[model samples]
Target: MVKFGVLVLLSAIAIGQGETTIESQCQVCQEENNVYCESESTFLRMRGAMKLGPLSCEADEVCSNSGNLCKKKTEITNEVLNVCGANCQSCSADRKYTCVSRNQAALCLNGQASSTIIIDCGEDEVCVDDDDGKAFLCVPSCVADYQKLSVPCSSAAFTTPTPAPPTTPSGDNQKSICQAAAVNKKTLYFFTYADSSCRTYVYCERSSSTSTDFTTTLSGSCSSPNPYFNTVSGKCQASVPDNCESEAPST
Candidate 1:
């Protein structure tokens, strides 16, 4: 939150028979306040006893911790950091967005909910509470039941193995998948593994509306913490739904 203040100074002098008073005006910024980003390019923080700035970040940079600190867009994690331009919302104790609808979730920032930002689940996906019920995550269409997706697809649930390729030699088979999407009038499609591993996904895009053929743009696994492709926001997210396989615990 942004805070504003007015500063006043006064002095009095006494003469033999009269007295005079002097006053001055200034602005106040507390030194102890935590730094926060006010926008993508600007931030406000304390410098000494005065408010520093809603200062501008350099080109290719965005605000982060202290107002003086800025970083490249690729250096920061979108889901974890309280960076500017995240469109944070107003939220209290429960920071997670409850499903506004079966397919939609609210976007939050710094424990506050954004007044306007909401995420819609992708095709064949639905908004559901995560395993701990501490947050909401978009899960597959087959998982509408209240029963948690606790069971792993295989018995070796605790091991972290390299993600296996799709069951059908799917990487060599982009034409069929892309054609299917094109037939449905969709120029773009994102597909996860058949095993619900949540580690890898594929992205395909048609060249044009007239084109029956498509190209694969990305086929890879997500990074740590956000090892799952969230169908709701169409981005990598931190949570691993119960239906998805879990990584081996760090020794």
Candidate 2:
């Protein structure tokens, strides 16, 4: 039986005429933290392809843009090497790759053919829709269910006086940087959006109408120390932070 990667590569080459002719072998590509499939011929056609860097795939996986993963004809190249551990399945399926065996960390997957990139949300974080909704992203458990997160700190996290709970205070008391409810008192410390500098952690609480009080803060422009918000954990983190939380919604 013909391997999936081999088949995709052959197909691309067979059609190359005016094109630079993709080699008759699978090729790898990279972007951000992702690995994908791209023909050498196609890469050369790109305007700024050189900025993308070298192409590669796992030793066991073949780079096939059509297959979406390192698998061919329904067979996976590297099963045990799945991202997010054995609890998950393929990480190169499509826009959102990954199979969950447990409620543990969800992986943000993206790639073409067999080469893919998997970003870990860790056990505490859950994968959700990115801003673009084109792909999945890891977000804090708190952010996922903000209506149920209880922030009971008696500090200045609340400035805008508004109505109390919708009906009754939710049964959420988990500790996280993303607060769902308004703190009773007013303080000066709050979870800010993750920024490139990771320097600010203070955001003025946005107040809602008197009937329902919800404190919403904008992204970026937070205080220092844990300025950048880790998107996955919905928590404030230090500079050079990972996990996708940030003032830049692009993350």
Candidate 3:
């Protein structure tokens, strides 16, 4: 009987050791602090405070157990801008705009009309246009166009195929004559109906000229090479030259 009891005790001890080995082999958590278990029955049910090791598990296993166990990392590029997504960041003029990424910066051209320059930024990067005056933040949609208008005397001529005015005068009466001619004959139309000449003539005829000042004259042709209109100034202003921005890429 003594020998039999001794054998039974040894058997029980061996069983306990086996259970401990199985528990150690099972992973209790994942790398991202997620809990995992191979078997529901093996999990401990006790509440209260339990000191657990760092949650560590294989990637595939962790993903299989919990949908939120892991996340894909984003790749950073060299062309990204430094001040991407921030407010009022300056842009590079050479390429028309600058972009910043987590690891690098890049310059891109603005392809759209009135588009502002921009930089590349990582998922959390911010950029802004210092030139905007309002300090607007840069976004993926941001683009820049820094070309200036070249307004030469010849460029002022109407581009439309329509016949030119009877003559291009050479004196002070040139502007006035053009206005009077445009009004009376209605034959002097701007290449683009919205030509600066149209505005100048209309303004001179309505506001500057009077019954007695009919002979008065203004200098320069009214046509402008630039198409932009400054509503605030109520006039047409020249745009910044591409070279000007090149010297100062930012702001």
Candidate 4:
């Protein structure tokens, strides 16, 4: 199962020396033994590190052997080179997120679990863990940012040490998941907003390609999006329950 964090969004830092952790704060780390040292190559990792968006690194910033990736420097025993896909960042300083060649929900269960690799997705996409915690996959996000999502749906986005939706299409302009179809193929996307209302939206395509517009499947305000879509009930639920055992996996 995925070890989801409880903190909101990417602010998953462990309190130390009476202050929260900040990756760019290298000077503070030098003064406090308890604090992790920020990576020396901050300039090199700027773009990638920002993607950490609201997520925190496993340790303070210790540079990866390649100097391109960063992770906590304390994980000496678990350090190993891992290959990440183009969708996600090449590596993370923390182990919470990982990259897999295949879009399997499975986390880094094998030898690579310790590496700081993040699953790949589009610039607007995010890595979403399943309700069962057995699988993690990349998908477009609903909340403008991770820090705002609510329960269950927040599990994947809020992967801090202690931190922590869907719908279909229709003929009505509002009922459709998107205004157009996917450029690659017909793919259905799910999202939950971080707004206090916690509205739910979906972007389903009739083909395998990408699309510019997405449709709102459900607009449950003040409610989080269910981790999995219930094909049986055709509604959003905490869990999909079936996991599509009787049917083939949907694209």
Best by TM-score: 1
The most accurate candidate by lDDT is 1
TM-score of each model, in listed order? 0.25, 0.16, 0.18, 0.19
Write candidate 3's Cα lDDT for 36-120 as tens digits: 2222111111113442111112211111222233221121122211111111112323333322221112233342111222223
Q: What is the lDDT ranking, best to worst?
A: 1, 4, 2, 3
User: What Cα-based lDDT does every candidate model obtain?
Assistant: 0.39, 0.28, 0.23, 0.29
Which residue runs of candidate 1 sit more than 4 Å off their true CA positions? 1-171, 180-185, 188-195, 240-251
Determine the C-alpha RMSD for candidate 3 after optimal superposition of all C-alphas.
34.2
Model 4: per-residue Cα lDDT over 79-114, one tens digit each = 221112111222233234342322212245342343
The residue-by-residue lDDT of candidate 1 on 1-251, one tens digit each, is 22112111112111122322111000112122344344444443443443323333444665554323456667655332324222222134555553333444554466643445555556655554333325555566565333333111111111122222223224454455445434445444434332345554444445675676665322434556576664333455688755354321121
Better of 3 and 4 by lDDT: 4
Clashes of 1: 8
What is the alpha-carbon lDDT for the whole of candidate 4? 0.29
Report, for all candidates in order, the number of backbone clashes: 8, 28, 26, 40
Worst 10 residues of 2 by lDDT: 1-10
List the lowest-lDDT window of 10 residues for candidate 1: 150-159
Worst 10 residues of 4 by lDDT: 156-165
Model 1 compared with the native: what TM-score?
Answer: 0.25
Q: Residue 129 of model 2: what lDDT?
A: 29
Candidate 1 lDDT at 1 equals: 27
